[model samples]
Target: MTLKHGPIKNLDMEGMTMIFAVAKPEILKTLKVGDKVTFEADRVKGRLTVVTIAKSK
Candidate 1:
């Protein structure tokens, strides 16, 4: 799995979390809104957009 570092915009009931990174959209497309992901950021560096999230059990 590729390691990505970015700012997490939002986290919903779904498993997915919206993230803002310098990475290209194509790379972002690969990630599902509800897919479990890991990121790193110091502060909010971007806008939070709506994303499909997975329900947590």
Candidate 2:
């Protein structure tokens, strides 16, 4: 799914919108299109992957 996220400072990336494959698709069931979230992503097998997610405070 596409996520509109701010800069991932840890990754040294600037803010932008992009597509991300979720590590746990089940987590999608708990999220809505516009919900603010904090997540961690990594390059797995040459793909940008969302490894963890949580509702933003």
Please, what is the TM-score per model?
A: 0.28, 0.84
Badly placed stretches (over 4 Å) of model 1 are: 1-26, 44-57
Candidate 1 Cα lDDT to native: 0.38
Alpha-carbon RMSD to native, per candidate: 10.0, 1.3
Q: Against the true structure, whose lDDT is highest?
A: 2
Give lDDT for model 2. Answer: 0.85
Q: Candidate 2 on 1-57: residue-level lDDT in tens?
A: 788888887677888999988888987778888899989988788788898998888
Q: Write the per-residue lDDT of candidate 1 for residues 8-45, one digit (tens) a residue.
A: 44432333324443333444555664466444332334
lDDT of 2 at 40: 91
Q: In candidate 1, what residue range of length 10 has the lowest lDDT sum?
A: 47-56
Clash totals, every prediction:
5, 0
Clashes in candidate 1: how many? Answer: 5
